[model samples]
Target: MAERRANVWLAAWRRAVLDRLPRNREDAPWLWILAAQAEADLSLARRMAIVEVLRDGRPHPAPDLQAAVEDRLGEGCFGAQVEQTLEADITSLRAWSIRIGCSDTPGVGGYYLKDPIVKAMDKPGYEEHPNPMQAQIYRSMGDARKMRSMFEMFEFALHQVGIGTRLRHPDWDDEQVEAEVRRLVTGIEPTMG
Candidate 1:
């Protein structure tokens, strides 16, 4: 019982950390658990290690990140369907980012990434749509500086927050992404918005 209580407390703490991050308003308790698992399995000191590496200017390689996940969270981190769902979620977000000409940086700044991802995730059809690889490239174009700060902020928000992968891409559309970008950039081409 004590052990279970401790686990619950830990999870809550993790959630608090992630909540503090910018634009991390969504609840993802699984992220906190994943952080614990990753740390336990890989000897990572904190949950932010994953973001640290990516934000530190290293390539945002999914395979490498997968390896880390596998090492830390074990093989069952996600079943096939869940994995596919996340893939689609990411794919849709990437597609929307491209449709609106957002940076494909490894770490796009809060300036762009937040609204697009949030708004895109709220769109329809993005839940199951798998975009082409070109979408993937455009989604990860942030330079070291942009990504590092973004990652740092994300890490801070998700510090101890549970890790979760949402199955639904509710906000998955280019129109929203484009609109948000236009709103952020001042004096930019009205057509671009």
Candidate 2:
């Protein structure tokens, strides 16, 4: 289970990077997901930070890492969340790189990339948007993630509302209770009856 979670994260990072890379091939839309699932690389923010650190062969501190990620993200928004996110992304990347046979150099100077991970870093041309087709793929990925999150949240909300419905009507059947909750929350009539 732990390994699977690590893999999911690695895939997420790969998708983020692929979204930025130039589109050399006009592959089918969803097929790139398979490619991301197969490769191990840094997450978007960590990859961006690594590139900055490698460019000048200097240790980039946390603040620099945060700014580099936000710059790549454009707008540089998100306030304090960017700091916490950068910290987690760096920590996850360091552990992931080691597990995948690459290691970071020892130092408080900055998190460093070593071995083939360094080679992967060199592949992305960091300063431009992907071609239009690839941009569409990236947008689709983001939309899918958003929809997944919404479904998860919606399920949780429905569960809570079902509990409330049960409280209000002890004699109601489970289906009836849930339908009431669904109707209230979504403002849509239950279609079953």
Among the numbered candidates, top lDDT falls to: 2
How does model 2 fare in lDDT? 0.57
Best by TM-score: 2
Candidate 2, which segments miss by more than 4 Å at Cα?
Answer: 1-31, 34-57, 75-79, 98-108, 116-193
Q: For candidate 1, lDDT tens digit of each residue in 48-109?
A: 33333333333334545445534433443434554463344345545645222223464432
lDDT of 1: 0.44
The digit string of per-residue lDDT tens for model 2 on 39-158 reads 433254345444544454445566665555544443343245766766566566566663212224544355444433345454567755568986676577777787887798999998
